[model samples]
Structure formats: C-alpha cells, structure tokens
Target chain A: MRYTRLSRKKRSIFGSVQLWLGDDHLLVVRSMRFTEEYRRFHLRDIQAITATEQPQLIWMEVALFAISALAFLMMLEVEAIAARIFFGVVGAALASTAVYDLVRGQRCRCRLLTEVSSEVLDPITRVSDFDRLTTQLEPAIAAVQGVLTVDAASMPVFAQPAPGTPPLRQEDRVETPAGKYIPLLLYFAILANAIAYAAGLLGRFNEGFGAAASFWFTEVILCVLLAFQPRRFGLKGPMLGFFYVTAALIAIDGIVTIALIVDLMQRIAEAGRSGTKTPTIWNIEWMMTAGKIAIAGRSLLGVVGLLALWLGRDRVVPASEEVPPSQPQP
Target chain B: MTGDLRCDSCQGGIPPELWNQQQGALCPYCGKRSWTRVFPAIQHTVAGQSPEAIGSESESSCFFHPRSRAIVACDSCGRFICGLCDLDTGSTGGHICPTCFTSPKAPGSGTLLDKRRVLYDSILLGLNLGGFFFFFWPSLITAPLSIVLAIWYWRKPRSIVPRYTTFRFVLVIVLGLLQTAIWIALFWSVANSPGRGSRGPAL
Candidate 1:
C-alpha cells in the first residue's frame, strides 16, 4: 500500500513526530536521532477525534521565548567583543523562535480515539493542522465505516451496570496531595543558579557566587524532600531521576566551590606577605578551569530541566484534585 | 458512551449531548473549550463472553487451557484455543495463539506483530559522522565499521515509510573511504619520515 505525508513534521529538541496517511490506515511516526517508532490506526476503527484548545500553553511558550531572548540581550553590555557577538546571535535566534511560534497562531492538543486505545497526534499541535487532519480523515473514515446519525444515540454502546451497583462518587476517588508545587520550586531554584552564573560572567562575581551558593543549599533541601515523596509530587521515571541527579550535582558543586574558595584565601595571604596588590576575585583568569566548568554545567542543566519539566507536565496532577479509578484517562 | 470521551486537560468524561456540536463545548470539569467528532464506530461495541466447559469426554479442549472447550484453532499452529486464550489479529482476520503471536519467528507472525524496524542507514551515517568530527582517533576503527555496515545493509530495508533514495548509504560509504584514506596516509607519512631511525637511536 502507498503512504502520503499528511501533516507537517513537528520538532522538539529531543525528537520529532509526523503523521502519514496510508491507503487503509493512518500512521504516526515518532522519529528520534537513531530510531523511528510507528503506530497505525485503521481507518474503519477510529471512533472519535477530539481537539482541545490550549491557549495558556501557547502563551507560556511565547513568554518563555521572549523572556529568554531579553535575558540573552543583557550580554550585549559585557566588555568583551566576542561575548557581545555570541550573546547577540543567541538573542536573535530566540527572538526568531518566538516570532515563529506567534505566527503559527493558537495551538491545540488533539487526540484520536479507537475502541482499544487513544493516541495523541503530537504533530497536530497547531489548530490549523488539527482542522486539516479532521477534514482529511473524516471523509476517508466515513467512506469505510459510514456516518453516525442522531438516531444512533438510542443504541447506547455502553451497557449499564447490574441492579444496585454503587456509582463512583467524588469521595470514592483517590485523593492525591498536590505535588505540582515541588517541581515548580525545583525549577525556580535551578533557574536562579543559571541567572546568577550569568551575573558572575558580567563582573559581579562575589554577588553571583553568593547567590548561587545559597540556591544550591536550598536546592539540596528541596530535592531531598521531593526525593522522599516522589509520588506526592506526581513524579516518576525521568522526573524522579532529575531530583536524584540534582542532589549529586549539588554535592559536587559544593566540593568544587569550597576548593576554589580555599585557593583564593591562600592567594590573599600570599599577597599580604609579599606586599603586592591583591588580585580581584572577579578576574576570570584567577578562576581555574574546573570552577568555570562547574558553573557552566549548572547553567546548562537548568535550561534542560525547564524544557523537560514543561514537556512532561501533563503527567503531573494537582493535589486538590482526585482522579477516579473507574474512568480510564486518554 | 459518555464515559468513552474524556476532556484532555481534566480527564473528566465529556457529555454525550456535546459530541457533534458545531461550536465546541466548554468542559464541565475544567471549563476548557473542546471539539469532538464522533464516528459510527463509536456505537460498535464488543460483548464479553465466558469460555464454555467441556461437556463430554470426546469433546476437544483448548491446548494450553485443557479444562475449557475449544472455540477456535490457531491460524499459525492449528492448535485449538479457548475464548480466553484466542488473540484476534483484528482486520488481519486471524485467531493466533499467545505463543505464536508473541514469537516473531513464528510463521505469519510478522503480519500480526510487526511494530518496530531498525534503520541501518541512519546508524551507519551517525557512526561515520560522529566519529570523524567528535573523536578523530576513534574514526580509525569506526571508519572501517561504517564501510562494512553500509555495504552489508545496502539492499536491506532502511525504513518502513519507504525511503526511496539510497543517499545516506552512499554518503556513509564515501565518508568511510575518505576517513580511512586520511588515516592510512597519516600513518605512512609518519613511518617513512626522514631521520626517523636516527632520532630514535639518539634517544
């Protein structure tokens, strides 16, 4: 059978997802750097398609891109010509992404449901894509399975429970405490480190270093608390692993910072004895390669952490809400 | 049927009354706008059935489940399977036993259980490119490996999506040859350099 491209490829940092229309089925291919996974739904088997508006998420992306672009623009004030050019290019790139996201218009979360499974059409992030997919799929599916009429409602596909069955109630559902705030807090702490590191690069070493040190201390406590009760925070798999990794990195950061501080103290003592001018702590030359590496690592982790959290946020649920056991989630 | 449709944001059931409305309905739980299009298949429901017991001594029983009466024979192995053990390959029109369905090597299993395919072209390309740029020294080993992989899987299917061109395989071969040639020339130049023996003796 022949397959034709149905939708434009939607890309993220890690991988991409695309849809293809086959002669008899619709294929969703998720392509990573090394491999591709395929999920096919027969045209006759599709039960329904739902497109939900996601204005808040689209606005979040716009704000994130705009704010990040502005933050990078701050580097233009740095004295180094190389630094200014590098940050300028980065800022321009971020600004362009923001514009692209805005021009794409509103986004939606579209899912295709069958009797056996429900699959998200990730490539149909834009509302336009959803409309196009539905337009294309509707006729093809209708040709195979025919159309549903208003009179069909009397059929009642779902069978009622036997007499005196207890209906699922709000109190019957499992009440999970809101674990959403912990991850948000972790994100804040990591972001603060990233900002502090940038400030240090711009001649505010003492303040930046102090701020980073304080945040790491706070992060250590937060990570430990979250690690102890991961289910409470609605974290599993990679999100849970992130907290463990953060704890390890915090320890490594502490060791590296303390070593740098001790070396700085020794240099100050030597300068006092020799009666020479004391070197400024803000001097990049004075900082060892290891110190520079540690700060940069922290900054990179912070950015990656933010993206990962945002992409996987759907799995997390608020504590105030209870999810019923009887109803299966799509 | 209402329970079948759910709000994406809140995971709450969407009311059946709003199933095919022109204007999207506000989700009762989260108050988000959601549009739904239901098809005729939504009304197609499968009724559950329990396997029957063996009525007589002469009656055929399920191969794996001996106590239960045989309902259908496996399309692959011809073994009788009860209702509980029969795995229907929907649309493919076959009733496969659990053992036959799970084993990819089983005859006719590919039609029922093909899920993933490895792209040899992509792997060959990554090995050649990543080795050459990131770790120059490792290319000595990887270059030859990429050459072998490219030639070995030249006719093998790369992607199920039908990538018509063999461009990646060709590129991998060319890159591998170039990288291997560079390493060989470097080794030759170093070994045959002037004063190479004399310098070593003086040391």
Candidate 2:
C-alpha cells in the first residue's frame, strides 16, 4: 500500500487540521504540538462524516454568570427589599444569557472518528476556517468511503401502516420507554405546580402574579418537551443545554419555595400572638405540611433526573452508525 | 453555525430554510448574506484487506496459520505471526502478536497499560466515611492502612486530572487518632469499674 499527501493548496491551517489520504485509511494529524499525535481513521471503520458549527465559549459570559450567582448571597435577611430587587434583575440577566448562547455559539466541529467514541479531529474556530480544506477532502473520502447518509426528506414514504397494526419496526424502536424518561417525573411535578399556580391566579392576578404564571408556564412547556422528545435530548450540544436549563429552572423553583416558607412562618406567628388558630387556607398547618411534602418530592425528582442525565450523557449512539449486517463489505 | 444558523450582524438565530441558499445565505434579521461553507455527509465500505499466503516451503510459517508467511514476532511471547496477526498497541513498534494481546492476564494486554493514574485518594476517603458509620472500630485497621497508602503512593504519580490531596491526608490522620481514642476509652471504663473482677461471671 502507498500513502500520498492530499491536495494542500486549497487547505488552510485555520483550526489545527492536517489530513493525509492513504490507500485504505485517512491519516489525520492535529497541529500545535511538539510531538504530533496521528489518528488513523480506517475507511472500513468510519460509519459517517458529520460536521457542526458552534460558537466559541467566552470568559466574559462566564464572569457575568458568576456575578448573577453571587447576587443570591446578598439576600440573607427577608426585610432587605433592595437586595431582593437586585437579585431579581441578576436572575433575569442570567436567563437572557441562556438565550444569548442559543444564538451566537457556532464553531465548526468535524467528527472523523469511529462510532464507539468521539475521537474528534479538530474544531474550527473563527480565527481558523476549514471550509476550503473540507471541500478538497470530501471527494477523496467519498471515493473510498461510499454513501453514508439516508436523507428522510428525499424519501417520499415512511410506510403508512394499516389499521390496528404496529407502525414501527422492532429495531427502529430503540428509543427508551416511558419508564426510562426520568425527566417525565420532573415534568409531572412542574405541571402540578403550574396547576396550583393557575388555581391561585383567580384570587389575585397582579403584575407579579402574571410574571410568575408566565415563568411557570415556560417551565412546564420545557419539561414537557424534555420528557416526550427523549431522542432529541441526546443530540450533543442540546443534551448539555437541557442539563443547564433544568438546573436553572430548579434553582428558581427553590427561591419560590423559600418565599412560601417565610410567608407560612409569618402566618403562624400572627396566629400565636392572637392565641387562636387562623381559619384561612394559607394559615392551616395541615395544608402547609402538604405543600412542604409536595415541594420535597418535586425537588427530589428534579435532582434524580439531573443525575440520570449526567450519567447517561454518552449512552445514545448516532442512528447512522447502526448499519445492518446484510450489506457486508466486499 | 450549520445546526443553529444565526446572523452575525444582529446576532439573531436564523432558520434552516431561510439560510439554504447556494450563492450565499441572506439573513432575514439584518438582511445581510451570511456566506459560509457547508459539507454533506460521507460513508465508506466496511471491508478489510487479507494477507497473502506463503508459497515457499523454506520460509518461516505463522504460529496461528501454518501456511501463511510469518511477517513479525510477538514482542512479549516471541511467537511468529502473519501481517494480520500483528496487533500494534504501541506506536514505536514492538508489534505484539494477537495471542499475547488477547490473553486476559498477559503482561502486554491493553487493560494494564494505563496512562492516567487512578484516584486512590477517593477510595481511601470512602473507607474513612464507612468506618465513621461503623463507629470507629473499622477505622483501627483502615485509618492506618489509608495513611500508609497515601504516603507510599505520594511520590508515585499525581492524577492525570488534578485534585486537592492535603485535606484528604489530614482527615485520614484525624480519624485514625479518633478511632484509637474510642478503643482506649472502652478499655479505661472496664478497668475503672467496681465490679471489674466479676465482669466475666459466666466464665
């Protein structure tokens, strides 16, 4: 077997990429190191070649987030109205930053490794672009690799099933069952909170109530999406996003929980001074106990779901990699 | 920005349909053409090349396949192997034969060749935590063992991923003394008791 250098005229050293075309494999060597490490991607082992453009993470956004987190520490005393308002603004800023990430975070990631592990070649940043390099190399890969992707959009029919028949094939149903959807329990808990939120809306619907209702409604929608669309949750960047978003939402829920506790304690103190039990639902000890139990259960479910998401982050393999054995290599 | 295409000018997220243009993607937000390169997916044939069989009777034959030509000898066991049987785990070439590589307990097996140092500190911390629950009795053996291990492996190598070790070492020592004190207290109470002589009445 002979090795030849791939056409390097069009290729630029934008993001530390050096590729060589071999007889039966692709020799990829990452740059910016004294001792070069070359990973040989065999044509037979390569399932698919996929690329994604993501924005580079900045230190400024991280610093801003740290400031937002520190704002929460200023509110030890409930009487500090100024500190409370400052915290509210910081929380809003952090939420806005999450939205900011969804927009501008795009760096080009080229996955040249096999299916088992993500042995990435190089991630191209703005300072270094690999568009022309990939354009030159794609043809070389296709010449040896063969066709890898099946575009669903190009196919007309997905096979509409007859009445009372199972539509999905057994192997195609590798998507986890409802029991494996740990986030569903969290979604149910959020829905319960949203229902109570809507019920409580009728008595007093002020500007603050409107804001709280909207936040809870947003949380309910996010949880529902996370619960039902388990397959989409496995997508690389979005999976990590789901984890962080869930954490942020849980933190907000905790702040609301603390406020409720403070209100309950105030009601109890008022009743003690009067030497009689308050008749209102808000002051009822049994109702308070039930609320505490529900909050504890919801928080417990959220923590469990977060742990599961972290542990099972790399569990889902790409669908393209699951090629059938019938089409054996010649 | 292939997955979540966005207009750099306005910093607004652009939908896939709006950005799917050959000439250049025109961002609807800022009305600027976001000219970027995008590549389609590639697939390959999953086949391996087979080694040639030996024809000459005088040539050295493979250990596994007697008819095949022997290309290299195993680094660990010195067994002759054909081109396909030479599994090189190391880059600098001491091409190990498949027999030594696949053998579970063999010295050259890939399992024992770890580059990153394992975290024994965490394991020691776990033992101390468990001993605390069992009320310092298990700590008598575990505390000293952990302390000894920590000091012994201190100069061996640090973790590939860095972590604090000073706190762990201090905690292990503190618990070791605490465990020793509990054992001493039990002995002191028995010796100072008024009915110490009749403590073992049944015996």
Candidate 3:
C-alpha cells in the first residue's frame, strides 16, 4: 500500500510532501513553489488502492445557517409592532445557536483530521488489491497544498504577529463581536420603553408615535447590523456610532418623555396643593407639558448616546486598526 | 528477552502473539514500535553559565549585545537593556532601551492613562445625571466639571488621549442636558397645572 503525507512549513512559503512507496521504499519531492499543474495523478499506473475521505464541514454549517434564517423570519411580524421584544428573543436564540454550532464544528474538524486520521485509514487497507493501487497513487496526493493569505493592516496593531509567522489558521471562522451593538441596541430599547411608558401614563399614546418610530427605526438598524457582521463594528466602534446617532434621537425623544413625566408630577403636586383631580390630556396645560417632557426625554437619550460615544472614544479602535482580523474567537 | 513485550506509541504491554510485530524491541513509553526508531535522550545546557541568586540578575541587557546585563529593563519591549542602549529622558526616570523603546512604536503614557480615565468619567457622568433626575441638584456639578476637565485634557498635544477625553466630555454634556430637561419638565408641569384661583383652575 502507498501512503502520502503532506506537511506545511512553519515559516516557508511552500509545504512539504512525502510519498511512501511500500513498506520499505519511499519517494521525496521538493519544490520552491506550489502549482496546480502538479496535482494530476494517473490512475492507469495504479495497480490497486484505498482512498482517504477528506474531512468536510459543509452539512453542519448549512444546517445552522438554515436554522438562523428561519428564526429571523419568524419574528418579522412581531418586529413591526414591538421590535425590541421581538428582536431580543430572536437575537438571543440565533446568536446562541450560531456560537454553539461554530464551536462544535471547529472542535470536530480539528480532532477528527489530526488525531483520528490514522485510525480511520487503517481499516481501508484490509480490502484486497487496495494496497498496491494506493502505493502508485501516493506521489500525486503529496503535491496538493493549502494556501491562506491574510491582510495584516486589518488587525489590531498591538497583536500583530511577527513577520514570517504563519497567517492565523482560524481566520476563516465567523466571529460575532456583539458587545458594541448590544449596548447601542439596549440604549434604543430603553429609550423606546421609557417613551412608551411615559406616553401611556400621560394618556397621549397616540401622539407618542413619532418618538416610537424613531426609537424603533434605530433599534431595527442596529439589530440588522449585529445580525449581519457583529465583529466588523465590534467592541466600541458600533457603540460609539450608535450612541452618537441615538443620542441625537434621544435628545428629540427625551423632550416628550420629560414633558409627560413633569406634567403628571405637576398635576399631582397641584392636586395636593389646591386639592383637585387634575384635568386629563385634553386640557392644553397638561397636553403641552406632556409634549415638552416627551421631546426632552427623546432628546436626552440622543445626547446621552452621543456622550456615551464620546466618553467611550477609546473603545473605537482607530480607523487604521479598525479592520479586525477576519475572525477573532471569543 | 524473558519479559513481556510492549508498544511504544500506546504504552500498552504487548502479548506473545504480537511480540514480533515489527523488527525491534517495543518502547515502554508508547506501546507501538512499528515505524518508530530509538534515539538517545539529549539534555540541553547553556555553556559556561553560572547560576546566580534569583533577585541578583540585572533587569536590562545591552541592545547590541543582549547578553551584557544592565540594571534597567527597557520601558517599551520589557527587555533587559544595558548602558549603551539606554536613552535617558530626565523626568521619566529610567533610560529608554533602544530595542523595545523605539519612539515610533512606543505608545505615550498619557494616551493609555487618558483612555482609562475616560471610562471612569463615563460612569461618573451617568451617575451624576441619575442624581440630577432624582432631585439632587448638587450632583449636577459634575456636568460643568466634566466639561472643563475634558477641554483641559483635549488641549494637550494631540495624541491618543484626546479621543477618550472628548468621549468623556460628550457624555457629561449629554447627562447635563438630560438633567436640565428633567428640571424643565418639572417646572413646566408645576407652572401649568390648574390652581385654586392662585394661578389657574386645578387640573
């Protein structure tokens, strides 16, 4: 039987391949460069042989991706009404499953290929005529090479590996840097909830639609960003951007929430002083005050979001270093 | 031999049936002996080196000659640097080591410190705003103080520091505005509510 072994160099550009012709004899091939032309193997020269199945992760990945898409679509209707509640549930589930599937797939691929390859191949040799055929084919198998290229400028400058170190192998994996987006999403959620609650309290829920729309729109955009590429705007980058935009919106929204809260408080205060039930939202006095507070709260969150972004400036990796490695696990 | 045979790879003792599994005696460490070769164990030692007391070793070594020891560690690379490689900056105390403390690569201390400080400032701003909402007017002082501190911090030579200082300043301003709005809303509600012939009808 023939066995072909391929091993990559730690620093050199090209990989090494060794072909064992039989129990005692072997053939060694070396090349300064790798080329597709070397991959062909002639089956006519082979007497008999067993084949090794290459490890693949297509099925598991497809299943998880399908599941995540399904979960996203399921929440679409509810998202139109109360997006925070709807997306919160959907996001939590999809993120969790995606994370789980990614981790499991990585472990399975690494272990089965590196540790169990020899054991699985051992049984294939038992077939008659397989050994002789494989021996002749071994040389061709050794020529195959794996190539990976990395853009160094995209990664954090602090963690850049010394030149000549192999580009990180795990770069192809998907990483969700949801930290920055979560806070921005949370800010919008809280602002929306606050506005809704205050508007309801003041009996002006209908008029509160503007603030609601703003809050919901911002929330949706943030959720979409998170779902699509969490790592691209990870850590502090998206948070700062979200805060600036949301802060502006909050500045507008806060006016409404604050107006309502104050009007309610004043009505209660006045009733205490003069001893009379406050007239409802219809009254110009109460309505106007509620309007002011609503606008204020809207404006407040917006500004607060901005401020959060500013104070969190260090959080945003500089643009030069903004492009994170394609994949950063954990 | 009279003893039981073993495989080197698996570390399992071999049975009589598999005694001649390959050409040679099995390794006791791992049971499998096929495709394995015996080699003498080698010990690595640094020649002409003497063991020194643990704390006595110098922190820095010469830049051109890494082995020549010096007292100070390079502020940048954390390498032991000797006198020839040490570049002295008077106020900062230790001389910067040439290898690790190159000017282009080394980040300024102020930049790192400012980033850390901004995080603290954000927390303070948030808390102060909360206080203002809860009717503690004195807590609003942080708003103005934060603005001043931010401006002062940012005014320094532009380094990585201003990014965080600006962030903190923005946070304080946002908090301040929110607190002011809350107060305004309170005033508006009190002013507009119906009264008992004092201002208007009680609502």
Candidate 4:
C-alpha cells in the first residue's frame, strides 16, 4: 500500500517520531537505534485531535540564556586561556540555540484520540504544522465518519454520560499529579551539586566530595523511580523530557566525579609521601579536561532544573472555588 | 471517554467552549492554550449488548456460543461467530475469530499483529562500528559473530518503511572479514617472532 508523509520527522538523541498517511489508517512510526515501532489509527475510529501550546519551550529558552550568562561570569573569573575559550564556546552555543528556538515560533503537543488509544504526534511540534495537519486530516476523516453537528456548547458529548453508564467511585477519583516530588528532588540534588562545586573550588575536599556523593545517591534513586513511575505518576510532555535529561546528566556526572575523586586521592597520597602541602581540588580540576566538563554540565543542569521547577509548580485552589476537585492544579 | 478533551500539559478536561476556537482558550487549571477539534466518533457511543437468542431452528447459531445467533463467519477458520468474537482487521485483512488471530501457528496471524520490526541492517552496522571504536581486541570476538549474524539474517524480512539497497549488509560483511583477517595476521606474527620462537630452549 502507498503512504504519504504527513509531517517532517522530529529526531532526538535516542530516536525519531514521524507520521504517515496510509490507505485506511494514520500510522505513527517511532524509529529507535535499530528497530521501528508502529501504531495505527483507522480514519473512522479517531474521536478527537488536540494541539496544546507548550510553555516549556519558552522556559527552555530562558534556561539556556541563564546558562550562557553563568558561563560568561565563569569566563571572567578563570585565568587560563583554554578555560576562557571553553566557556566562551559553550556560552555562544547555548545562546544561539535559545535564539533559534525563539525565532522558530512556539511549540505544541499534539495528541490523537481513538476509542482504544490516545497517541502523541511528536513530529508536529510547531503550532503552524498542527494547523496544517488538522486541515489535511479533517476532510479525510469527515468523509469516513461524517460531520458531527451537535450543539457542542450545550451538549458536549463527553461531558455527559451515556445511558446505563456507571458513576465513578469516590475512591477511584484520587489522582497523583505527575512530578509530584520529582522536581523538588531534582531541586535539592542540584543545590547539593552547586554547594559541592563551590566547596571543591574552595579546597574543602571532604565537604565537597561528601555533597557530591549525596547528589549522586539522589540521582541513582531518581533513575530507578523514573523507570517504574513515569506513567504511574502521570508524567507527560516537557516535564517528562526534563526528568530524562536530568537522569542522563547525572550518569555522566557520576563517571566524571569518580575520576576526579581517584585523581584527588592520588594527589593527597603523593603530598603525604613527599612531606609537602596537599594540592587543592581546584588546582587539580582546572588542569583536567573531565573536571572542566563536569563543572559545565553541572551548571547547565542547574539552570534547566530551576526553570523547569518554576514552570511546573502546582497551584492550590481555594475551598470557595466551584471547580471540580479532580482537576489537576498544574 | 465521557469527558471533554484533556489539557495536554495537565490532563484536566477542556470545556466545550475551547473546542475548534481559532484563537484557542487558556485551560482553567493549567492556563495552557489548548486547540481541540471534535469529531463525530466522539458521540459514537458503544453500548454493550448481549448476543441475540436463537428464535427459530432455521437460523444458524455461533459455533462457540451455541445459544447466540451468529452474525458473521470468521475469515480464517470459516466458523460462524457472534459479533463479540469477530475481530475486524480493517479493509485489507478481513474479520478473524479471536482464536485464529491470537494463535501462533495460524497461517495469516503473524502479519496481522506485527507491531515492531527489528532492523538487522542497523544492528549489524552497530556491532561492526562499536567494536572498531572501542578497541581492536573486541573486534577479534565481535567480527566473526557479526559476520555469522549478518549472513543468517540477510534474507529476513526488513523494515516495512522500505529501503532501496542492501549496502549496509555489504559494508558490515566486508568490515567483519577485514577485522578477522587483521587479528589472524597479528596472532601469526606474534607466534613466529624470533624471541618467542626461541623461548623454549632459553627456559
């Protein structure tokens, strides 16, 4: 059967998502490193398609700019020319990415709902692209399912229950919003890392590495929690992406921290044997490539995590408000 | 499904006023702008129904459920089935009974439920390149293994997405052979070295 590409493929580090219009179905294909997974929704079965503007992209832009500013500050403090160049390059790259994202327009999350499944169309990130998709798919879908002309304002089909439908139980009505404690966990971990970094730069070896160890421990726990609880916690969209990135950054940081610790131990042992003063951690860190990278990664993660926490903050409604208690406050 | 379209960010129900609005509306809970397009299928309620009882002996009954009237015949097994048992596979694949569709040995069951495709070409490429990038010693082990796998899966069904060439497989095979040859030559040279060859007498 012939297929027409519906949207341009959106790629990430791990995989890419694309949409294709098939003979009787719309196919969403997710291509990973070595395999391709498919989900197909028949034209007649689609109930609704939604596109919501995501403010996380704006937060991401702000975070990147903040990181660039932090890098500029670091560049001013560093004495080595190599360190200055590294900071300058990192700052430029992040600033350019932020500017590019700003110019590309707002991002959106598009989801397709059928009777059985609700699937995200990740490739259609831009609002304009979603509009195009709606225009193209509507006619084809209407041809199959026919146009529905209910007084949507008065008779929202989903708002009222069908005949013989059972009411939801109060016990089953409880909801655990996504990222309930995850952002806070990330916040504390980032704070610990920042303290550790500052302490390390000040030559307080024990205090610095101890804080680093705590950050590593927190990250390891987070990795395990994220693996099992992503869906259970109702995590979705950009917040989900943020947690994944945090997990990855921590893994890299773990390796770099271990290397730095090993190097520090050797330097301390050498100082003891030679009857000389112990070398400061900063003195050794500035001299190593892995140390520099660890420091930079820490700063980037800090900025991003702080912004994500701010954006994803939950609001508590007053008791006088008539809104349904089941509604998520995010 | 008896609710409005949910906010993409927070999963709260969107009011009907937000549906198909050109400017979009801010969600009451999350304040995110949601653009929703409702379709006829949303109103297509699926109420559960018990199978019709056989009123006359002339009417055929379901093969599995004898008391219930048969609505359609299973495409694969040709057995008369009730509406509940008939699983439609859209326009291409006809309706099938649950037994035939889920049966591993059924003739046409494989393609009907195929949700994923393992791209052996990409796997072979990764194996070949991973070994080379990490170290040459690993190539000694992975090279022969990849060569065997490449040949074994060479004729296996590839991705349904379609590709024009087998260039990746060819490249993998060539690289595997080259790595194997290099390892063999290195081992041969090491064994035949003058110092190593004369080591027995010196010991």
Question: Positional deviation of B102 in candidate 2, in angstroms?
Answer: 2.3
> Model 4, range A62-85, lDDT digits (tens) per residue?
577557656755665578999989
How well does model 4 score by local distance difference test? 0.70
What is the per-residue lDDT of model 3 for residues A1-330, given as tens digits with 9 covering 90 to 100?
233442221123553322223222222233222211111122211111212112234455445444543444344434465774675476456556654433322111000011111112222221112233233433432332211122223222212222333222232222322233345444555566556546744656654544454444445444454445444335345564564565455455556546765876787788889978775554657566655565566557645764674465333222332222222212
Expressed as tens digits, the lDDT of each residue in B108-178 for candidate 2 is 44332222234555566777667767875777677677667767756644332223656666677677667
Residue pairs with colliding backbones in model 4 are: none
Stronger candidate by lDDT (1 vs 3): 1
- Binned by DockQ into CAPRI classes (incorrect, acceptable, medium, high), candidate 2 is incorrect
Can you rank all candidates by DockQ, best first? Answer: 4, 1, 2, 3
Candidate of highest TM-score: 4
Per-residue error (Å), model 4, residue A211: 34
Candidate numbers, best TM-score first, in rank order = 4, 1, 2, 3
TM-score head-to-head 1 vs 2, winner: 1
Off by over 4 Å in 3: A1-96, A99-330, B1-121, B128-168, B188-203
Best by lDDT: 1
Question: What is the TM-score of chain A, computed separately for every candidate?
Answer: 0.42, 0.33, 0.27, 0.41
What is the C-alpha lDDT profile of model 2 across A118-220, one tens digit per residue? Answer: 4445533321234544555556656655533444343222212122332232244342221233344344445455444434433432332333334453354
Q: What are the lDDT scores of the predictions, listed in order?
A: 0.70, 0.49, 0.40, 0.70
> Which segments of model 2 are wrong by more than 4 Å?
A1-77, A80-112, A115-330, B1-49, B90-94, B109-119, B133-141, B148-203
**What lDDT is reached at residue A185 by model 4?**
54
Q: Give Cα distance to truth, residue A79, candidate 4, Å.
A: 12
For model 1, the local distance difference test gives 0.70
